[model samples]
Target: MSDKAPKPLNLLDYHRPKRLRLKDARIPPLNAESKRCLRNLTAYRPSRPKFPYPQTRSAAVLVALFVGRMGDLYVLLNRRSATLRTYAGDTSLPGGKWDPEDRTIEDTARREAFEEIGLPRDKLKVPLLCILEPFLAARNLIVTPVIVLILDNTLRFPFSLTHSPLFSPPLPRFPTEPELIEVPYHTTNEWTYPGPNDTTLTTRAHRFLTGREAGGIKPVFGLTAAILIHAASIAHARQPDFEVELAPPEGQSREERIAWAIYSSPVFHEAYEAEEIKVDWAKVAKTAGGKGGGRSTRR
Candidate 1:
């Protein structure tokens, strides 16, 4: 394969000289099934997550996903600035500590994104999917992982969205016409593929970095890897993979194993035992009397 970068896949006038499909508009389109898989992940609550350490400070991170040009999905990741005091230069989901003025952890994620990187609120219009089971960081921080969706094409956010719980099986929905936008070509060199040419970063993430092939690729340890594994599993499982020999001691299948992985890790167990995990839905959503909402632990 050529080592050259792929030509920018701008959708403007893109399908004119080729085949046209209803989804061939600017920004990517997601069907009902994809949304269903995501809902299942967001609503997943582990019975026990390790408790957060009392001495730890609280922080949160954003796991943002967007559809790629070829209909594949890509999660946002940043190589943290090397100058920071800790976890500096590590690959991370965009987020930071909750501040007094922020309405919720979701707000903190978006606000930090704007403050850390330059994702202006105008350019990014992500809808809050839901928060994942919290994970504890090595720094003694209880961290909530917030999931958000990047809508295809539109620059502004839709005021409100409604959807059912993940319990119902997903029914297929067809693509509706989307408002189009002409994205001008502006190239930057910072973007790099996180995995090998043959496989996606999603694949390497689920198939954890537990082997000799660990060189060169930035390590995605513990919670970050777990979140990616969860999200990537949902994204790729639209057509399920064949069963693997690996089983979680109880002889459960792949789906069962995926669910089990969250709580079995050290973070969840420690957090649960320490009694540091949050249970109130409204509190976790940051809608209480203005303070004291938190979630966390990891393996």
Candidate 2:
């Protein structure tokens, strides 16, 4: 445990004055394509974790989408400052770890966006489209992707000079006539591990080359890339041009895999306990080990 004391929650930090409210948040009229995308996003239902998770280990990323001049959909992204200690110079969505003062996961996302990119915290200006299921990240952190639409693009911000903003169309777009939306380029690597009852579970990690002429932006890979793939697939209502990895026919589903990880991995189990949630010993026993279970570690 850390020697530092936990920060106290401040409800008023998230409140905005009534004088700042406006009848029109400067949101432009949505085109037909934008409307369809919005409808699809609004209807999406993301999966949840099978076991309880500690809020202290949670983080969020804002997948902010907007309409481009040609009515095509685009997402906002930034290259991290190279001076950062971890994942420096990487391309990522605007977000950070959960804060004690945040009232909810959505609040954590909104607060991080406001602090990172100067995005207004007002919901009317940038409305949320969806909150995706949690993804296990490095250091046993659970990252939730918050999807929101940037209605008022005219809002200016004093973004950090170290962070460079990059705007690109959502994935898997072809070079349509009279437009230069580049083709999506990506590659996947498969990973497998032994499971309960002599079974084997496999998953794929994806890497997307952000090659749209951004001078200093790094490629979107790992968690960031995977989240974008999911968001784009939902928004466009079509699968990616390339093959996407799925659980084996007889293996565990995505949620089940996460649950298995929490039960099997010592690091994750500690997180589960830190939340003061009781473990289902029966479920854990069912997935603990088997005759064919290998000793290889999972990344």
- Please report, in order, the local distance difference test score of every candidate based on alpha carbons: 0.42, 0.66
Residue 254, candidate 2: alpha-carbon lDDT:
46
What tens-digit string does per-residue lDDT give for candidate 2 at 1-299?
45443332221223332221123445456567666777788777665343455566678898887777766677878778889899988888888888767777778988888887888887877887787776667666778888887778787666545665645545444222224346445567877777766677777777766665467667778888878877877877887766556645434554555556655678755554554455554554444333323222221
Candidate 1 at 188: error in angstroms?
Answer: 33
What does candidate 1 score on TM?
0.46
- In candidate 2, the residue pairs with backbone N, CA or C atoms under 3 Å apart (3 or more residues apart, or in different chains) clash, namely none
How far residue 196's Cα lies from its native spot in candidate 2, in Å, is 4.2
Model 1 Cα lDDT, one tens digit per residue, 1-299: 54332221111111111221224333465556555555565454433332222211446787766654545445666555556677765556667776655545556667776565544443235555555555445444556666665664443322111110101111111121122124211111111222211222221121233121233334455456655554545444443232222232323332222222222335434534344343342332222112332334321
RMSD of 2: 6.5
Worst 10 residues of 1 by lDDT: 161-170
Report the C-alpha displacement of residue 280, candidate 2, in angstroms. 1.8
**Which candidate wins on TM-score?**
2
Q: In model 2, which runs have C-alpha deviations exceeding 4 angstroms?
A: 1-29, 161-184, 192-201, 249-252, 284-299
- Model 2's alpha-carbon lDDT is 0.66
Q: Candidate 2 versus the native: TM-score?
A: 0.76
